[model samples]
Target chain A: MKHLDFWFEFASTYSYPAAMRIEKLAAERGVKVRWHAFLLGPIFKAQGWRDSPFNLFPAKGNYMWHDMQRVCQRYNLPFVKPSRFPLNGLQAARIACWYQDAKWLSAFVKAVFQANFVKDLNIADPAVLEQILNDLQLDAEAILTQAQSVESKARLQAANQQAVRLGIFGAPFFIAGQEPFWGQDQLELALDWCLHSEANLSSFG
Target chain B: MKHLDFWFEFASTYSYPAAMRIEKLAAERGVKVRWHAFLLGPIFKAQGWRDSPFNLFPAKGNYMWHDMQRVCQRYNLPFVKPSRFPLNGLQAARIACWYQDAKWLSAFVKAVFQANFVKDLNIADPAVLEQILNDLQLDAEAILTQAQSVESKARLQAANQQAVRLGIFGAPFFIAGQEPFWGQDQLELALDWCLHSEANLSSFG
Candidate 1:
């Protein structure tokens, strides 16, 4: 079976819907998914945007909120406009990166996304993250400790660098071989491409 | 029984694909389409972007071109990257705005898009505009002359103000009632909304 790399940023509004559904879609098609948690902060800083483009452009921001509501409605994803527009994703991402091979990775990631997007909790808060891990029946104490270790931090930094090298400007981005598909709207296209790609898993990043 | 207002800019890259298929799509859904040819130059200027955002942001530009390829491939629409990134859409928009209710509006709109995104022609030139009109078997000289009338100019200007009031910051935007959907990816959502909106054609703009 072919596979695709799913690059997601925890605080990315669109990535929330994508993260919740990617695995099921991939499973249905018998394709594999590699979840890569990376930061958009470094990438946006490189682009000279001090804030999310949504916040930077008021009109776009206004439209985005409404679009999100419509999208959530269409997908039947429960949504509550977070009191905080973009709560920091660093802690959640670090945990996700450190647990890249964890069997519970997708569940943890989805829980964090739901906490922030559906429940209006700040994902940057360690207490919130701890609760998420506790609910997942994982060793929260050990995982949190491991997530803060030098090796874990280095791994996350490496993922950020790889995201930059892959020319990812936003999330959730997908890679099938060397081809990239950006935005939640392209999820199916990316999955279908992954299954059909001649290069398949060999050339996927 | 229902209708939508399609906000398009001739220079917009994504709008090229939307323009070509909107009529067909709307027709299939038994929805009426109001082609609102408006200028993005003014809207973009207000947002402090002097050039197309594609030129301002290279990564987005790079991704957009490839995405266009993938989208066109999926839609079976022919596409060729124009040598001029965003050829001036002012003249073409003026013609479209003036002929908003003409029997040949959709044909003329699609032809102009084809000229820019398929044939790679400079749509800004009057000769190119005249040739498109001629090919449509219409009175090229008369329509071209009428397109420049003061009333025609003001009508297009009014559309620009209306688009701004509508908070449209992007092309391939659709309005069903008061609901706004941006990007070609949202085309079906907009059309569906138009069809199902309780207000139906009454509240459509």
Candidate 2:
């Protein structure tokens, strides 16, 4: 079996689509995926970016919304433009970090994506997050409290650092050995490399 | 009978893969493609970008190179890093502007992509472009001379201005009426929309 390392940020619009589909696609291809959740905020700040570069450029932002619409239609997924661009992904990322399990992470990601894109909820709001946690039947207070812990903060910082070292500047990135693939659309090709590359395959087996 | 407009830049790496495969894919789906060649250099400059944002950030550039290799491998196409980060696409774009026939533009684009990525030649160089033109059995001097004409230059400018007005900031963008799809990977979805959208398909019949 071959393996793919999936690195994603909760706030990334495109990552939502990829996160929703990657696991199923990988399963069909008989590949294992290791879900790694990280925060892109710190990385962006380090680069002196105030927000997602897409948001900084109005034209790019407009184009992205239209692009997302087309992609969502193709995948038969609902897409509504989020009212807020670059929502605070801290709490969600923290919960993802705390759980660190593939199943929980996947569910959390799907919920967040749906909440932000479909339901148009402000993910940054603790109340909204609490509701999501409650719906998942998880310990909402405990998780939310833990999300603010010093250890949790350090974990996120480390993830950002890891992303920087890996030469990742965008969300929805995948790494197979030294090779890195950016964007959700490249998911299939990235998985293919993991499945066929002798060096990458050996790691999973 | 449905038609989708493909806007591409010769400097775009992923566009190579898309241009090579799109015609066959469109034919299989019984869709028609309209190739729109334009230079992104002016657009980027207009947006106050000095270069491709990928090149502005080292991490992005590094990841993109590796990512493209995987995609090329999956497509079984040759992949090699071009010597120049962003080739001067003005000459090629000018040539494409002269033709409305999709087949000619497609073949020309494929040749230029091969020249830069496979042959590792300097596509920005006039002599190299001359050779490419000669190989294609097109008049090198005449095309080059015509490419310099004010009329051809104005056409290139107009094409770029059209891209910006349509909210496009990236290479390999597609438009189906008012809907826009960015990136080479999104071509299929763009084509699907062209084929399915009542407003667009009506024009075909």
The top-ranked prediction according to lDDT is 1
Stretches of model 2 off by over 4 angstroms after superposition? A1-3, A26-32, A102-105, A177-179, A192-194, A197-205, B101-105, B199-205
lDDT of 2 by residue, A24-134 (tens): 899999988887788887788876787897877778876667667766876989988888887888888878876777466678778988998889999999999899888
lDDT of 1 by residue, A46-143 (tens): 87888898998888998888777777877999999999877899878999998898899999999999998899999988999999999999899999
Q: Give the count of colliding residue pairs in each prediction.
A: 0, 0
TM-score of chain B of 2: 0.91
lDDT of 2 by residue, B15-77 (tens): 888888888888988888888888788778876778897787777776667667766876899
Report the number of the highest-TM-score candidate.
1
Candidate 1 — what's its lDDT? 0.89
Worst 10 residues of 2 chain A by lDDT: A196-205
DockQ per model, Cα: 0.46, 0.45
lDDT of each: 0.89, 0.80
